[model samples]
Target: MRPALFASLLLILVSAPMTADCPCIPLTHVWVVKTCNDWNCASTELAVANGDPQVIAVPVGMNDSRWLVVRRFTAGAAVDVNDDSFQLKQFDGMDGAVKHYSGMTRDYHPMLMTAPDGQVLVLSTKQPEPRGRAVAH
Candidate 1:
């Protein structure tokens, strides 16, 4: 092989792994619950450009409990809610534990709450599964 061609191929092979292993910058957004009802709560939406911590409320009671629901806001958004670069964290209070959610089964709607000790809990309604055709294993 030509010396120049061999050197070029060697350089490409050495740099390929580095580029693949490059870490991605984290994308974060905080939603502050302003009002609550039996079903869902209203939250303040902060722009994606703002990289500040929005005020989050601790669950007061069963009626005032809130869940951090994840979804894609835009069709062409760079990061999806289930992406590793995207992260969701819940805090009980200023000095409470922080819960991180990533790479979980995607549900149409999931009710999630963070305990005072940073445990992530899920709330689900007891409903019978809809009938569907079974697939052969």
Candidate 2:
């Protein structure tokens, strides 16, 4: 191969951009998740342009790496909830817990309590599932 061609090829390889990283899940219309080491690393609150916590405590949950309902915080923030980037106030400095919390409609499944364990509690606003066919009285 020509020397110039070989050098050009080398330059192209060197100048290529690295793999685009996975995007962070936005917690509220505010915070987003950050990742490192091929795993969720931390939860960071997005400054309100002027630097202030979004100040909304949407409940967060922790699943056991299986996305199953392990526990749910009815009073936490999704601001870093969809991923493992939330801080557990009661878990004794246990950070880096993945939050699968999703489906929010005017802040009303859960209210005023935390699930037995922290798992992403999908907010269900609809009424309970029907039991059988309806009948007129």
lDDT, candidate 1, at 81 = 36
lDDT of model 1 at residue 75?
29
Using TM-score, give the best candidate's number. 1
Candidate 2, position 102, lDDT = 24
lDDT of 2 by residue, 5-85 (tens): 999998888766455455766452222222222122211222222333222233233223311112222234433345543
Candidate 2, TM-score vs. the true structure? 0.21
In model 2, where do residues sit more than 4 Å from their true spots? 18-52, 57-137
Cα-based RMSD of the predictions, in order?
Answer: 17.0, 16.7
Model 2 Cα displacement at 122 (Å)? 15
Model 2 residue 87 lDDT?
23
Candidate 1: list runs displaced more than 4 Å: 1-10, 17-19, 36-89, 92-95, 98-112, 115-137
Query: Cα deviation of 132 in candidate 1 (Å)?
Result: 56
Local lDDT at 118 for model 2: 32
